[model samples]
Structures are given as C-alpha cells and as structure tokens.
Target: MQIEIVEVLDQERAMVAFNSPVGSAAGVWKGGQGLETGTHHVEFEIPDEVHSWSLVQPTHGAITGGGARGGDFVTVHGQVEGVGEDSVVTLRIGPDVIFVEMEDSVERLNQGDYVTFNSPTVEIYPYQT
Candidate 1:
C-alpha cells in the first residue's frame, strides 16, 4: 500500500496515513527503515503476538489508529483468510494482505470470519522494485 509519512517521531517511528480503497488510517510507523515526510510505497505487518479479537458483523474494511483512537496502536477490521500454526493468521483487508501472529492459537477462527483486533504497533517496510 501507499502511505504518506506525515510526521517524523524519531529515526524509526513516524505518523503515517494509509491510502486504502476501503478506508484510510493514521498510524505510527514502526520499522528499522528511516522515513521522511512524503509518500512511499510500503507493506505492513502486525508484529505483536495478539491473543484476542472480537467477532463483528460484516462491515466495510477499515484501519484506524493513533491519537485519540489509541496511542501507538492500530485497529484492523477484515475477513479472516486462514489460521496457521504458531498462532499466525492471514487477513484480507481491502486489497492488502496482513499477517498477524497471535499469542494464543486462532484455531477457533475460520476462514471468511469477519473480525476486528487492535495491535500495539504496525510496522511498515518500503517495497522494493
């Protein structure tokens, strides 16, 4: 996805806006890569070991984070693609595929289940051509 780094918090953290077809989201970018103010192509991943999530009625996919929403946290709403070993799960949010590592097994969640969960951080890696 294409994201704009709106504010630089530090060398490895910044505030970014995700340009998504479904909905836009503002979040704190956490990665080893340094970023300046501007738009860049990048991919995101949930780096935390999530243990719980809430099942919600099917709704439009969206990403929300930062500021009043939650400091250094992100909320993602999407459909479950599948659950794998080691508590890793695949989720399809709009056109982006996000991989989440859960602290607890996600065997209870089946494919196509729409769920929402908050992660403490979302890491962005610049996409290389």
Candidate 2:
C-alpha cells in the first residue's frame, strides 16, 4: 500500500492528499499509523508542531507531515537512515532520530530516502506550460 503525496490543500492545517493503489490497498493507508490516511480526494489534517519547519525540494519525492496527538508521532522528515525491519522504519530528522512503522505492509521504503520534517516542500509536478 505504498502511496505518493499528490497535493497540498490546506497548509495551515497541514492537510494533504496522497495517491495510493486503487481498491483495498487505498483503504489500508487511511486507517493506520494514526496517520489516518485519507481515501480518494480525502484531505488529511496534519497536526502541527511547536518548532518551525525547514523546507527544501526533494530530488525524487514529495513531502507531507503529521503528528500523533500528545504522542511521539511528531511530524518529522529526513533522509531515511534505514527502513522496514518487520514494520519499523527509521528516519533521521536533523539531530533527532525518529522511527515510523509501515502500516501499509506491502510497500518497501529504502535507505537515503528523503521524507518530511519540513513544510512547503517543493514538489515538481509534471505539468504543461
């Protein structure tokens, strides 16, 4: 159930939509990790943080953010130090080390992958001039 961040709708709320495989796979994304992944056209409201976000354009992926309410699911993104050891993926967001579980068990995230921890990430969408 690997998905790609497709659009940014409400920046203030950190609301966004990600595109996943059609059918049941899509449902899996919306239901787990407290990420509360949304269905088609569903906008997820990403919780906020006390610190300001640092943004940059990724060479290969898009960005999104969320945090678990009162929990450690902080909105973090950085180069993947490693990924998926039976459902857990580790990310290094600056000086902090963060761990994320792959709710969508089918997807394979890899090392050196750049993920969120910043806002307004510059995504170069394929477009027509």
Instruction: List clashing residue pairs in candidate 2.
Output: 30-37, 77-116, 77-117
1-129 per-residue lDDT for model 2 (tens digits)? 234544444454443445533211111123322343332333222222213433334533322332222222333345667866565556554443445444443144556666554322221122112
Model 1 lowest lDDT segment of ten: 9-18
- Model 2, position 57, has a per-residue lDDT of 45
lDDT of 2 at 129: 25
In terms of TM-score, which candidate is strongest? 1
- In candidate 2, stretches whose alpha carbon ends up further than 4 angstroms from where it belongs are 1-74, 105-107, 117-129
Residue-wise C-alpha lDDT for candidate 1, range 57-115, written one tens digit per residue: 98766677754444566788889888888777888887778888866547778999898
